[model samples]
Target: MRVLSCIVGQHNLWLVLLAAVVCVAGSWVALRLLLRATDRHGVQRSGWLFLAAVAAGSSVWCTHFIAMLAYDATAPVTFEPILTMQSLLIAIAGMGAGFWLALYNRLPPEIGGAIAGLSVAAMHYTGMAAYHVDGVIAWNMNYVVASVVLSVVIISAAVGATIRGTSRNSLLIGLGAFVGGIVSLHFTGMTAVSVTPFVTGAPIADATVFATMAVAVAGVALMVVGTGVASHLIDSEVTHENIAALRHLAMTDSLTDLPNRTGFNEYLHFELQRAEQGGRSLALIGIDLDKFKEINDLRGHEAGDEALKTIGRRLLNLSRGGEFVARIGGDEFAALKRFRNDDDLREFIQRLEEALFKPLTIEDLEITCGASLGIAIYPQDGRDAERLIGNADLAMYRAKADLTRTVCYYEPQMDEKSRERRGLAMDLRSAIEHKELELKYQVQKSVESGEVRGYEVLLRWKHPERGYIPPSEFIPIAEESGSILAIGEWVMREAAREALAWPLPHKIAVNVSPVQLMHVDLARSIHEILLETGLPPRRLEIEITESTIIADKVRSLDALRRIRALGVTVAIDDFGTGYSSLDTLRSFPFDKIKLDSSFMKEIETSQQARAIIRAVLALGKSLDIKVLAEGVETGMQLEILRSEGCHEVQGFLLGAPETFVADVVAVEERRIA
Candidate 1:
């Protein structure tokens, strides 16, 4: 009690209060650093824990001596150098042991508190022993024991708060308890000391040296805390960068570096919501390049990739502010734009064509490609992203089919037709397995004697519910969906097997789709079918369109030669419709030319049609290739064809393709009898 009264009366009050505030501030920062260090990598735990010890130990050591420096005991007092330094070593060693246990989560909260309390007692008493007053020192054993026990209780409270702390409030509570405990330990230990004054023989150590040491301790604490905070920030930034890179990879196309379908869908939906809330107009445009597959087939996939990259760059450059463009499929792209007026929409469409129509140069080869675009407007075409894209897709199909207009807007009727087409395509996949499909035959007759020379095979589908679906509606769907490959092979086997049972020596002609002509193994597959069915190759004929050969002339010609070498005849059907018919005929030899029915329809009304028919007949004679007239619906058309020396004819007038072969044979028997 006498020691407290003497120091309080003489000590500088301002420095004592400053020391108290600095203690709390320094301890808070050190605790934050310690927690962060412990949470980091285990392999680096010791390194970070060492830093924590530096920060924590220096803060406590500085606070204790700073308060001690404020002490004015009325007698000159100098600290013993060895004992002062030993107090600091004790502080650092104890902090390291406590932190190590806490970092590894090995000790209980109470046990950590006991360690901290014992450390405080050791450091405070050791530091007091350094204060040489040139007189004997006495201690109150009861107060000394009380100080130690009070430190235990206070430090225990701090440890409890720290263990339970996760948020700002709990952290503040923990810091308050810890700082209170340390300050209490110091003052209580001071109250236990009593000194007797005497005349000193030795001069007191300079006060300036103690002040310099105090500043050095504070600087070390600051450096440790600052370094830990900087590292944490850098690690956080690196983690964010890695996440962004992964997101970009997920959203972008690997080949063209454009937003893919998944990214496009998300962007479209975001724009749609914004436009809806603002009552603004939005447009979704679907674009598909014409004959892109042919480019890939003729050039190479690498060239195709370069072409696509060029297209993506061009489209990205052409996009206006608030507009987005993406590649949704191979050879297919899309654009979304916002507009306020019809003129703006019109101008956008015009610019789109100008940008897309530009030629692309890949590997020093200039390639020309045209794009077809379809537009669907907001609040008019659809209210949602999915419906809008679908409607635009339907309009794009119409634009592709109509040669006059390469860009068209959505119409209500197109939806119905598109839905029907989609439904038919889905159903057609299972049609063969269900036995819902069959082949009918139409007789091809000799124009002079009217003798049946061959029968053209026709596909007919009788749906269980829809009843008698027309070939014109479903055949094109099958071809587009790529289901025709399987259907075609099925037809060949069926036709060959049925023809083998026929009594007459007539050929059976099956129409081959352009898709089937692309297969290199078609000839080999057909040979296997003929052998399995026991049908002579001479009795089966493969009919293809001129467009098929025009697509890939060399490949088509090679495939045709291989099939013809099997003794199967190859004829060109719908001859005049394709470009360069005569050139095709000259380059590739065909067994027969079925004149397009447009001439047969025109032969009655126009002399030009008759003249063309005669010219074709004359050309066929010169080449020794037979000419046949298709779609001969009237006697007048048949008579005109016969007069023009057409060797064979087949149409509705003579016979619509019969569904049953037995009926056809019975009719032929009656006519012959």
Candidate 2:
């Protein structure tokens, strides 16, 4: 009614209302079209821009509409109110634009479009103000100059933002944008509406409107760029964090947090190259954790993985960062070190030996395991990676043979020995299938009575092609290949059968590998073998190395107690060869202890060996346990053992392990005879 009345009554209110609505609707439509164009072109679309426009306009619209609901109040019309409200409206709109523009501050580079749009909008608002407030002091020559200045400022900001601004660099460009905006706003104000007062020619207000406008522009520019810088910095940091994650994955094991095989290989190759080029001595040591499979099988794989990682961390911590160490395979690790001299290398090796011997606690249980280390030195032992690793691995096997924290440098003769050993291992597995594997009995004599006692049944492998392959030679091979489980099962069965055949009051001893000990159902297996072979469980003794019990001690002890409960004898075989001493021996319940052959072979030549043997025998006497010495080849060893009150002796002098069941019969026949 007012619009109709305006044209007829010569009133301007109708025209103003129509124009205001058109401008508002037109602005909204323009933004929508712009967003659509960006989407169609596949250019980067600004959803934030759309959100911003909606927020500012919607706020203004609601305020206007709510105000209109008051009696007789409709939307304001005519220059009087439109001009009054224009500055405040633009100021609020500029704030909305700035808020959204600042959202990208954490990005590495500020986008050019945001800077350009904000710069232009600042000038545009000033222009709109001038248009609304006519005859303001700015309506002078400054109008043209302000427009040029504003255009240039916006162009500069566009260029700077387009080039991209990193978190660090955005600040400089943002500063430039601020200065430019201020200059443009000031000039635009100077040329806009006059400050002339109600009196036609009175100069506008106390301070020139242009000057005040310039200050406001300066403050607004400052706010916009400040937010941009903050956003850019955030993105930079996020990108850096992503890179760090990738590097961690590449260099470390996911499970163990130690260096992985890739890392190990890199270090090995690097050290090998450096050692070769520098002519400095470098040693590569390969360590294989003994009977690791048993631990996994018994405790479950999770516990096993924990054990491996724990061991790896211990080795890594023990090593100086200068020495490269990594887990190269499951239950196997490789280390490379460059040393000053042979002694220096040996010292390092000794340190590693000590480090490995420390008790490893996993899942709140103290577990023991012995590692065999093979050393391959640069120049002397190998010239390259393949040869060095191969030789070191073979040497480790030889060291494993000794069942000590044994470290061996590769030797040419070791190659032949290793090949022969591997060949024997392969044949030994076949031997079990071919029925060439047999158990023999050796007489156990009482030192006091000089009378026969219980016999020890030892498994003997006589390869058809390689006659009488020694237990020392083939035993480790089988153990390493995991064929030992089968060999072990066979050994238990055969030994039990042989013992059942013996007539006199005698028990039979059968050595079990650490692998067999780890059998989760070992107790059940033992019971089955005893039942099948007609041997009383009480009469069978199972001999195991100190290394077997030493590795993962708590678990081993638990297994030992369970085996003992089944009435099977538990003896620590190769008693003194492992890292454990008599102090740790207290933890075990040993019915008998077998003196290792190293002490046996040197009994006559070595006074220390004799002393060790005598001390062990004395220890057995004190503990009320039986002591026996195997591989007592000479009368000197026998006489020494007899003198020391050793309970039994098994060796060539007494009798070697034989394949013939008749030999056991003959021995028992002799005792019965």
Best lDDT among the predictions, by candidate number: 1
**TM-score, predicted candidate 1 vs. hidden true structure:** 0.70
On TM-score, the candidate that comes out on top is: 1
Candidate 1 ranges beyond 4 A from true positions: 1-212, 376-405, 408-415, 425-436, 442-454, 462-468, 476-490, 511-533, 541-673
In candidate 1, the residue pairs with backbone N, CA or C atoms under 3 Å apart (3 or more residues apart, or in different chains) clash, namely none
The TM-scores of all predictions, comma-separated, are 0.70, 0.57
Candidate 2 lDDT by residue in tens digits, 43-104: 22354344334433333222222212111211222123464355445534653454344334
- 1-673 in candidate 1: lDDT tens per residue? 6546644764556556656766776677666766666566775667666766666666677777877776655456878999998988887787777766655556666576667667777888888888777666788988799888887788767766776577878778878888988887877777777767667666654556545655565566556556656765675687689889988888888877888898999999998999999999999999999856656755778888878888888888888887788898899989888999989888888888887788877676676778899999987999999899999999998999888988999999998888888899999999999999998999999999998989999999998789999988888999899889999999999988887767776899999988898964789988999999988899998999988887788888999999999999988899787656898899888999999987887899998888888888999999999998999999998888877789999999989998887866776678778
Where model 2 places Cα greater than 4 Å from the true spot, the runs are: 1-130, 133-223, 234-430, 464-468, 502-505, 578-581, 600-614, 667-673
- lDDT scores for all predictions? 0.81, 0.63
